[model samples]
Target: MSIKALITHIQELVSAQSGLAGLNLGLVNYGVPTKLPAIYIDGLTFLDDKLNSHTFNLCYVTTDLSIEQLDYAKLILAALQGSPCVQAQQLLPRPEPENKRNRWIIPCVFFPRALKA
Candidate 1:
């Protein structure tokens, strides 16, 4: 399948969650949302194992960084991990700048050969 299809699948899964009902999701190189709990594709790479690694950023844009931001990111991570369509890899926490926003970089791999094009 194409990257767009993967993005669509992830959007659908995240949308299905009541807690993330208002979360804004977007594609990378397009336009990322300025709102909190916003998720967007960050990068994509082809693996030698016939899999594609898709990197996504789940971010909370806030002037006041708190534990709530981390918690929300965790929730998103859970939803992403629960997806049966792709193999969720890892959720890497970004180092906070103390004055910058909080974000989690998640990398998920999917076998393109197994998915219908």
Candidate 2:
């Protein structure tokens, strides 16, 4: 799938989740927002020369200091795993936020039909 399509898929998945309705979601270029519980499309990488295999990051930030951060990651994984295009997904190390927020990135890979062969 294309990058735009992948982004749309992520958005749809997040929206369909149980408790993410009020969360602030955006793209990486939008910069660090003042809102809590935010998600961004941080980065995208093509794993192959043909762009058929791709990996992207879901950057999630929140002010809550508890393990609630993991819920978002799990929700993302659950949604992505249902798609045929998705090959794998992983959670990266939690990064120190600029302020008093918890930040993490969920990386996911997609192998389009062209590369499924």
Q: How does candidate 1 fare on TM-score?
A: 0.68
- Stretches of model 1 off by over 4 angstroms after superposition: 24-37, 49-64, 113-117
Number of the top TM-score candidate: 2
Model 1 lDDT tens row, 1-117: 476776676677677667765444443222456554467665555543433444434333333367666666666677777776566666677756774766677666655554545
Clashing pairs in 2: none
Off by over 4 Å in 2: 22-36, 95-98, 114-117
- Tens-digit lDDT string for candidate 2 (12-113): 766777766555554432245556577666556665648667766667777776676677667756766666766546666585656667777777676666
Taken over the whole model, the C-alpha lDDT of each candidate is 0.58, 0.64
- Report model 2's TM-score to 2 decimal places: 0.69
